[model samples]
Target chain A: MIKIYILSIFLFTGFFVNSQNLKPEIKYLQIINNQNNKFIINDNIRNAEICADSLFYRIDTYNNDVSSFFLLLSESYYLLKKYDLALFTLLQQRILFYSDSINIYSKKLLNQCLNKTNKKLPASFSILEKSLDTILFVNSAQKVDFLFSITFFINSKNTKHKLLNLITFYEKYFNQNVSFGMAKWKLLNTAGINLKTQTKYLLINDFNNPLSDYDNQDLLYNLPIKLKNKILNHNT
Target chain B: MFFIGLLLFFASEMFSQDVDFYIKNQNDNFDFQKMPKEMSFDEYNILSQSFRMQDMMFGFFVPGYVHFKANDKKTGYALVTLSSLSYATFAYQLVWSKNNLSDSSFFYNLNNLSSLSSDLKTNTLIMGGALFTIGSSYLFDIIHGKYRLQKKQNAIRYKYSLKASLSDAYIPNKYSNIACFFSMKIYF
Candidate 1:
């Protein structure tokens, strides 16, 4: 009986070891990390792309670690000035990691990639707007930041009307019984700035105006004065 | 001893690579998906149907049943409150009759008819019936709401394939007729 027990234990140990070996190995992780470091820290785009591609080709698409590997591959493509390929790879990653912070990062990177390719700014603004709308109920600060970023890209007359409507929505929200949290204030200020910038751009027709030209002067100096006075009167 | 400990560690590490652990750890990462805001079509249909059934059954007797179905909360509350007050009045009259019955003087007087006046007895019966009807309707609404919520969740996760087809059907003694059919294939 003792001999049989000993034999069974040996068999179990051997099977366990074999099973461990059968599991897909992340042996490429260290190599991918090294390549990423070389690209990010040393700024050697060509060598990093070669190394990343070689390592990435060894990885199967169905592998559990494929997303991470693809992220590195996309980063390499971005460093290599291959914006289109980078955008495509990030989009693929977004499909796999839907509604993840990694997807958000991919979107930010996509915006940058599109900007580099000289695609229309409205398309990028639309992406931000969609993300903003998605996270509106969950994260107010992120929603405000998205609105702030959108203000930079609103150039045409039609988009300006849309922005005006958005500003009014925020203004009404702030004026209502809703708690005036930091995010609300930030959103209001962003709307004011957007209005001022749009007015300046429309009146001057100069997109290249320097920031120093408007120093110490409120761009929304005239628009919000009445609202501010009303608020002050209510407080007093 | 060191070798055994190392073996145990390796075994645990290998065990931790199981699919459950992988999924649990993956879900721990931050997710940015939006919460669903609007009622689905199935949910809307269920609510509206529940409202219609209540209207058909009790709209005349129950004043705010239709309003409640239409999502007028204030009117619904007012009707429910009135029903409750009527039920309370019936209870109070029953208690008053019980006290009168226990009073020997009133029982022997032969002037009062069975300790409760005929008008009060009739009013109590009407109130009781109205209360039962309104209460059952409210209870049905609650149960239907719960059932619809569960069905909505299931519908969100359920996968379905819908196929619609149109074909020509031959008639024995007349022109060919057009036939249309819808096929729904659902996977749970």
Candidate 2:
């Protein structure tokens, strides 16, 4: 009778323990916190190594049931400075969902963005944009759009299209009064050298030079004559 | 279910061969072994989070390879057997589809010509074969999502079945059990 009762207790506690084990959501939150605090956490290579090993251990124990694992893995790899692995791992997971099931919305979108940034894979901008166009797909689309815009802004080749995509995405799905306008300005400034429009290029170039108030100071700063000429033309 | 599992396992194993071949034939170069284990700390953090999300949260999570005890010896085997099975099943379908292509042109020309063109018949068979292979593999991937769950269950079982070790090392909370501890033997 005692053995039977003890066994029941054991079973109940076993269930309880597992029920409280590191949940996928909790794990993901921890990883995000780590990323935010990486400057502190990364002060020691030993600490970084410890965290990396811990993450790998957790990943190895993960069951393929969680939808977020692939995302978490991608993030973890990114943190480890393993850009190729992070991108490749995400691609592998995306292929699994794409070639297998319909529940591949986020993975496919993220894959598209990463592929574009890496320039290792083909860009499916239309497919990503089309999916993000839906209201019901808002949550997934927003998360994916954020990644897309960040990747696009960083990429040197498709600055115009990337900015346009971000602009369109924000204008259509997000509030116009938001900080996305700041992102637009940054993009324009970054890609300003290639701008064909004289006014637009000057606006960016003036912001970069910032020498209208003092001429001798600008000369001492060795500001380029062509840039000074462009600035003068814009001011006049 | 066991037979189905077995069937799926072999099928996926077969399919992986075709996928491997196709991926190889595409001339897209990648050396998986040469790739870095970890990148930026942020990237590592994300990959870890993604893995946990994929494996532990929504689905039965399984690592690719895990240690299992068989006859008192630690043996590492693939935790996700279904992945291998799906590959095998896909392979079988690919091979089967390749062999069953109908010579439509030969039939179309039967009423007009006395002989069928050998090259046309051969090409049709080859093209059909390739499509069948690709189509079957694609289908196998779709069908094997559930099998992936089963593989995760097997991994948990394998973890539980390991023999108890002697040392009672207190592992760190931040680190995973897998890499938290190591044993050192000292002779004084």
Candidate 3:
């Protein structure tokens, strides 16, 4: 009994000391997450509005985890059915995090927005996509798989007639674009094997690695016999 | 229900392969393995909060860890079994799906194409359903553990929140548990 009492006192004091020393940023993140739970999962719009406001104020665009804030904000908007606002928020995220074209989460949210909308994508989206596509070929992000956000966007249920034409154009454009390794891994994967080779589009290679990159345009289009042999063989 | 949803969200967050991959691809400065070299007391104090959050997150990552934490051994063991079975089922299905795909060939023929799409849809739906079950068990474990801990905390807090004025002192044998007894009571 006495030991239990001592242990309890130790824990109490530790908690008190810990609470007194928490970082304001960290504390605010906790508060925001709790409020997000109330709204995002619990479906409390009032709390969602409050959460969006709190998140909006605290977002440090320079912070690495700032995407989480942007995502949460967009999600709050999504629940509120303000999809255009959601897409606009994600557009800002896309432009700011220019190097993160491979981020599937943002793309998925964008897909949800596009599927739910009746209108054509704003001109800004076109302008942004043009610039981002340039980044994709020039300074290719290393961590990206073959699946880009546009893949997700393409798969979204087309609500606009203009969007259908755009998807068809994109389909022809990206047909030959996935990394060799990602394409092979798809064959090994359950869903990948089921879908025809043409349907698989994701960013799956590190540009830094020659083996993964397949820098030669022709080699990128067709996986070379030697590349196949090296992968299939246990020893390189 | 609210707590269940919260636990499920964290459970998925803790277990998501995509998030794991994303974290690996992100900058290395956030890695917890290496300690920061030579920090002031301020940084150290702030760092301690991360460790505390990590302590909470540990409960999220490990199946039944929270239940064990709350001292419900029976429930904890049950959760462990359930989650293990859930993982096993998911793995088995994945393996089956791969093998099933390998055994089949896609053809441009209309009949074959329709069957292939249907098979793909069914396989994916099965995987999604199994994942939902796995997530639920993890959710249950966390909620039960937290609820038990909260119950204990409320009991302790209630005792501590009571306040009383010191009064009728050591009246012999009046109060056996203490040195003195209070006549006037205050409740908060």
Q: Write the per-residue lDDT of candidate 2 for residues A1-236, one digit (tens) a residue.
A: 99999899879867654433324333533444465544322322332233323332232132343324455545555565545545543543343222233246555555655665465332443455445334233343343333433343343432344344444544555444223323434333443435443223323233234233444323223335675454445444
Docking class of 3: incorrect
CA lDDT scores, all candidates in order: 0.43, 0.39, 0.46
Write candidate 1's Cα lDDT for B1-188 as tens digits. 99999668655645453423223445533743332223345434443343233243354456456545545457567766766675677577567755654443322433444566676555445545655755765564455444544443343332110000110111232222322122333446
User: Which model, 1 or 2, shows the larger TM-score?
Assistant: 1
Model 3 residue B16 CA deviation in Å: 22
Q: What is the TM-score of chain A in candidate 1?
A: 0.30
> Where is model 2 more than 4 Å wrong at Cα?
A1-5, A18-21, A24-67, A79-81, A91-105, A116-236, B1-188
Q: Give RMSD to native, each candidate.
A: 26.1, 23.2, 28.0
Candidate 1 residues A123-163, lDDT tens each?
A: 54456446643442534323433443434343333233334
CAPRI verdict (incorrect, acceptable, medium, high) for model 2:
incorrect
**Model 1: residues with Cα > 4 Å off, grouped in runs:** A1-220, A223-226, A230-236, B1-122, B159-188
DockQ of 1: 0.01
lDDT of 3 at A100: 59
Q: In candidate 3, what are the lDDT values of residues B57-137, reduced to their tens digit?
A: 775567777666655679888888877777777687678767876544222222344445666656655656667777887
